[model samples]
Target: MDPSVIATLTAVVSAVVGGAAGEAGKSAWGSLTALVRRRFGTDAAVTAALEQADTRSPEETTRILVDQAHADAEFERSLADWAGETARLLQYKHDVSNTIGGDARITGTVIQAGDISGSVNLGTPGPPERRG
Candidate 1:
């Protein structure tokens, strides 16, 4: 199983369980459950694990899915597909909306960003300014 796939599944599960994904998250979660049921419905343990996702840790649920994916090639492919789709849906939920309105005045540089991972430099380095 790919690490990225695991990361995506973890994120989606966290978002859905945390109630932060909203309608898109709910839909993605539903799709995931349906996919699991279609692929592993006969397995009572798998179904139970999925059913208890909200109560159990996201990592645990993810582990169950990952383990099953490892056993079945087709299930791995389907799981990857579900992770990809869910990732896109979750991305939509995180759309950034930046706005400066209602008589807002700008003085200097105004930087707007979303989901920045590392340090952000807006300008070149300069000597410290002295105040008398």
Candidate 2:
């Protein structure tokens, strides 16, 4: 299985699990299961794995994804594609409000809009800055 695919699925699974806790978790889990069913309808193994993930803990769901990926190469590839697409779709659906990464600092107001298609980059311009 491709490492990138595995990584993508891992991330998607984590996001799904993170939302599997309270009243909000219930709603999040429901949405996730619906996505899985809609995308992989009639696939017995994937369907079974998704069912298990829904009922089991997040760690268990991660284990299931990894194990299944190892067991079936073709399926693993499909899962990676599905996971990447699903994650993107979910982000759009939820209207990703904010995202921050690395040690970059933000002290001023920042606004971003993705009307149709747009990208906002706040990374340091020019050469990388050295840190003491």
- The prediction achieving the highest TM-score against the true structure is 1
lDDT of 1 by residue, 1-132 (tens): 999999988988888877788787778878888998998886897888778888899999999999999999999999998888888878866646689999999998998876777998878799999999
Candidate 1 all-Cα RMSD:
6.9
lDDT of 2 by residue, 1-132 (tens): 667766766666766666622343345556656755665676786667767765776556756666766776765665666677766655655433456779979898677554446656766689877999
For every candidate structure, what is the RMSD over all alpha carbons to the true structure, in angstroms?
6.9, 10.3
Specify the highest-lDDT model's number. Answer: 1
Clashes of each: 0, 0
* Candidate 2 residue-wise lDDT at 52: 71
The global Cα lDDT (0 to 1) of model 2 is 0.62
Candidate 1 collision pairs: none
